[model samples]
Target: MTSTTTTPGGPALELDDIQAGALMPRPNPYAGAFWGLRIDDRHAGRELLRRLIPLLKPASSFDPERPVSLGLSLTFTGLRALGVPQESLATFPAEFQQGMAARAAELGDAGENAPEHWDKPLGSADLHVVVAVLARDTVLMESLITLAGDALRDIPGVVPVWYLDVHVPADGREQFGFKDSISEPAIEGTGILGSNPHEASLKAGEFILGYEDETGAVAPLPQPDVLGRNGTYVAFRKLHQRVAAFRQYLQQSAADRAEQEWLAAKMVGRWPSGAPLAVAPDKDDPELATDPTRNNAFLYGDDPQGLKCPLGSHARRMNARDSRINGDVRLHRMIRRGTNYGPSLPSGVTEDDGADRGLMFAFVGAHLGRQFEFVQREWVNDGSFIGTDEKDPLVGANEEGRFTIPNRPIRRRLKALPSFVVNRGGEYCFAPGLQALRWLAELDT
Candidate 1:
């Protein structure tokens, strides 16, 4: 598709106009809520957007000054239900229309997390829109949801079909005891220090529309340019972690306390403290993990042979750093922000609690097919790039899977690892810019 730079000489990101959740996540949100909306009436949905637009928080508005934030995104069905023209809708990425499950094989979601097992609200016929609310604590977040729900109650067409609450422990670990959301791609325009210093910054258009991307060319946009410019797509997923199973595997695979810790780090490519194996291969470095400036400074170029950090590791597979040979890694970058849900299983407990707990995964990008889906299919679920057929050790479908750890005497392979993470539900939506939202609200339809 032919394209032209929309922002041109202007700044790539107008932080004040973009949704807060699209750029950065609220630090330590005590409680978060996601609302799955289905538009039953067209005009009423637009009316709701008209009123809700005033309450949406912009990315620049996030700071110590304001502790609560709310974000809104709409799916292809949501847009169409609100009376968006067919010609205009045709401009969206093709994969977004097919939905995430259409490419299940590439994504390796065919097992437990397959679409058939997904929550009814996610990727369902009724799922049309999504609203994400963030707050400093559970009480405040609930209050906001109540107020928003009350306001929407009068709007006959739009109603919530599903909801979820998300949180992270004060220690910031996911259910599996890893420091989550630690590695992200730095968008050149935002200056967010997304990846480590060794990694180069990605073009802003890779994550946000209207700007030049890695190809030095602008990405294509929908018609009535005002409605499409500055908007980006989001992939939201509810991942359930099998905490009891993961702990049991670690116990049976390792010989001692130290070996158990080392084995876990090898599976994740980072110590539980968040220190990368490439930086602290032999031991955990709590100090380095906590250091904001140095934690992400190391690279994989020196360890090309996967001697320090295994090529098939979770982190290494997700971000190949200097190891990628076939394509420009910058083009495939995404802005990831997520929150953990469910209480941490008591330490040393290896039995199932059966409580629904896992990660609420959110990926923001301009190209859903190339950026988000490509990573899920190629990097996270397969190992051809790293010269092995192994999948991501921590989240991959572990059907007789084997994890290879390069060692001094000989490489150790952990076998028969079970799938530790399962997909509960998810959706693909469009996070529109302030102007696009205004356009939607004012549309004559």
Candidate 2:
């Protein structure tokens, strides 16, 4: 049904495009345009989406306060019919090259023997599952997962249940009021780069911060470690929204609108301007959002105890820009991308003044322990990073397990902290290759 083959002296494979017969030379602007289908056949899953996408109409520009189409996500899982060859284990990069080549040739985006391996991350996926998400909200998605997962498991390669679900939404408010989704990064490539180069380089195993395994450091000879030469591990977390509760808390407390804004700023660790207290230290840089060079440039120059940025401020705690060297930033880095989904606050709420919504945090990198967890636990939760009594003023983990925003905007305080972040749902996954998919296809036959 698809055109694919090896040619004499061709280039390596292209792994960016997930749709069959479509190897995008770059990341698609529409990663937001995806769905899930765990079916009786592997090729069937790929073919179905490939055909369906083209037929579907383009998404319309979003309105600030309304629901758009509900979203669904897919990640691969399980192994029944597929059988990978022994040689593939020994020569994965080469095999990965082969598969990318075949898929690219099939796409006609590249000619036969184009000689290109996926510039994006590839080589681990073999299953697909979906998470249905609501526009302007995060609640329904988790509920849907809890609802639909049972039905989906009946499909093939469904064991351990699901692989990756759909992706996390972009951070930002639909109406653009508070600095929405301030922590989200604009992801580049097929996402295989694993968030950022600093942490991604350590994917094969443990590195600088820790090394529990042998292949922890990058190999001099060019080979992968135990996880599979081309494998990548993905962890996803989805939290819920409690607009009414948040509004009630924000309204009843705080002084005036400016004070409310200050409270909001303190909780998030930044003014809506994206300016870090570490540099601006005192004011909001509203213009930074427009200026690329200025927006994300603040660093914790000499302020160890958050003399500039508050120690527990979201920015300082997450990156520990507050932590330092002869003035060098920590080698550990994570490319974080997140989105806010929920109904906007009712303007007329006299009891609760602000809007009702919450955030979705997503990070991609090699070692989860060093990067994501590090930012969350050490800086955000532990008082040591900032030398303050406050934990991550906003995102500290709650007992229920979700990392939802706190009921009130956290302010500087001398007392013990109340956990703000709460967990709703999450899973870890691997984004694999088309060869893996075909290996999957062959099994179905």
Candidate 3:
């Protein structure tokens, strides 16, 4: 294998060796499935990768006509199961080695969101390989699923542990009725542009290993060049959204339907149509929401007071975007992609329906600690940066929480905000480069 090196002008990324799902955004109106597998035998696990190589698509070969795609990632335990040398294993980052469950408390996954309460095989070491299949519709999605199933059928020691189907609703709104997947950061060599024009392209190393990052430093690769060069860390989370509870909170806090919508937008920093409150603060502009050029093109410099978009809103806290925060916003940026699972709660309903519905969130980047975990801890679960003790209004663990909306006469504050999103379970895995997959398949040990 050839070693990846940087030049005076930044190295051109090995897109052919990079997984498509790790960089490109999913197609809208997409249907997908997530599968967790346990590697009981090292030989079988290696064989699994051999059969999966042709099915996986590279970042540079995306075709609109062939919309189906597949991605593969392995947990730390999975690498060990495949007989990875102890020396190579020690080179991975601490967060990736410890896994998500071990860092629960630091990530605000306490109370009902603890790891012990997580779904089976999710927080456990039994989970080794993660397979994600996605396509434009169910017909295409099922075709790939069948192909993936065939690869695992005759393998003796590769057992299917868990599975979840995901899709975008007809209205393109998440369970809480908000347009999701609206924002993403641009990478220097990928050619994919950022949603916000005001934002500059981040260095490739920020998201891919073996390249220079925002701080002008290349992140430490896992080991032996070939296995870790084009690889990236992925944080997979299953967040259960309490739609009834979310709706009830807005209904009780507001005076009318219009007021309810306004209050919801304040909490989210965007109208239901995917329009940012920074651009359309007074009302929900459907046209602006649909316009790709202007929907996510605003900044927080003018609204430092949080009048248009609350400083603590989910969107602002996640991105910050020129906001006077304690750190560089670009350094903490990562590619976030999500798909809705389970049925949506019917409109005008404010009662618990006992259906498990939420988002299967995936965070992709090279620096997992600084990019993903930092945002979850400081921005989502804590508010000290914005001079408050409140968590994110929509997704944080908000037991008896309060959100303040800055105004001229007096800031109207909403009290007793409940935790609408619960941490069902999650994992820390490494999506190796295409060459690394072949290396693992031919491992002698």
Candidate 4:
């Protein structure tokens, strides 16, 4: 008995109790696979969530002949390995109970991106249950990973340690070629709109749990309210990408190859065909980057001196829309999603092909500390609110980074700037809803 809709003014979501990859989008030549699961036993993790709730599918059963979906999340030690109550895990949110590897120095994730150099049951607690799946390729993502490996055949302790497999490359571009998951946010009642039609929507409890957000209140749940109403919190990660040190640091900071593709489109304010250097600032237009209403319709408050983008660009330090930062870009909006893993680097190869490619990011929200750890500690690892202490010159954590670029007859800094994305680990999930996965498979524990 789960159903709700209401949008004319907001608050009523329950799109059949959410989770269709937390608000559907990501099916453009897809094929995914995440899996993690551990749950040593609590009745085999409630019989692997009652055989994955009849192969989960909601968010009003998305479409395109199912385009293949499936999602599920957990951790907070998989809700205390499925037993759940320590006062309902003390009502969740301490940045999702100190997860994401105890907030890795608040997400700059230090030299060689820490968490003791991750990638082992990713930031473990034996990594309890993630299981994603997507599709539209790899033969329907291996027939939904063989029906999620036949619901972990013979469950027992429920292991399946880890797995990755992400995709999207029919020229969708992301092992740093760019065009990644354009922009996302618009949540209100989730008719899913925001690719920036001047951005408004937000408030569906800032992304699902219970309701009313954008601070008109209600953004804290996770107790008996049927296991946190229509849950949502996810984070995910697993980055990596260094595609031959980002194409030999854009061929030693440009002078050829069309100024190294305009210095990788001013450090990614977009145009490996996702357009937008505040709307095609003089180049790569692939027809306005495949025009979806003028590709994320421009606005850095009309380029505030960053000469069409670069206010420490990485999509304008991730959504600084009307520019002027130092907080409140719609209270740090998030919903991001990405996918691309292994094998891509061969176009005029800059070298390092010991390939273990990148990006499997994800975020969804309900305020994991004001939206994904405040956009990974203030817009992708700090740049002094765009004044520059320098980071996010394309996935920060750099050691010798410095990147200004406002230019016309002057500003083009870029010195050194290494660390082309690494941190191969991450987590801080929750996802529930679908009647909170049938109240976590009728938790009688």
TM per candidate comes to: 0.94, 0.55, 0.98, 0.35
The lDDT values for all models are: 0.81, 0.38, 0.92, 0.83
lDDT per residue (tens digit) for residues 152-226 in model 2? 444453333233333233333322244443332322222222322222222212211112122335322112232
lDDT tens readout by residue for model 4, 246-322: 88888887878998888889888877888888877778888878877778877788778889778988888888878
Judging by lDDT against the true structure, name the best candidate: 3
Q: lDDT (0-100) at residue 361 of candidate 1? A: 91
lDDT tens digits, residue span 249-281, model 1: 998998887999999998899999999999999
Q: Per-residue alpha-carbon lDDT of model 3 for 303-327, expressed as tens digits?
A: 9999999999999999999999888
- Backbone clash pairs for candidate 1 read none
Kindly provide the TM-score of model 3 when superposed on the true structure, using C-alpha atoms. Answer: 0.98
Q: Residue 298 of candidate 3: its Cα lDDT?
A: 88
Q: Report the number of clashing residue pairs per model.
A: 0, 40, 0, 0
Native RMSD of candidate 3 (Å): 1.6
Q: Which should have the higher TM-score, number 2 or number 3?
A: 3
lDDT of 1 at 146: 82
Model 1 stretches astray by more than 4 angstroms? 1-12, 64-67
Q: Rank candidates by TM-score, best first.
A: 3, 1, 2, 4
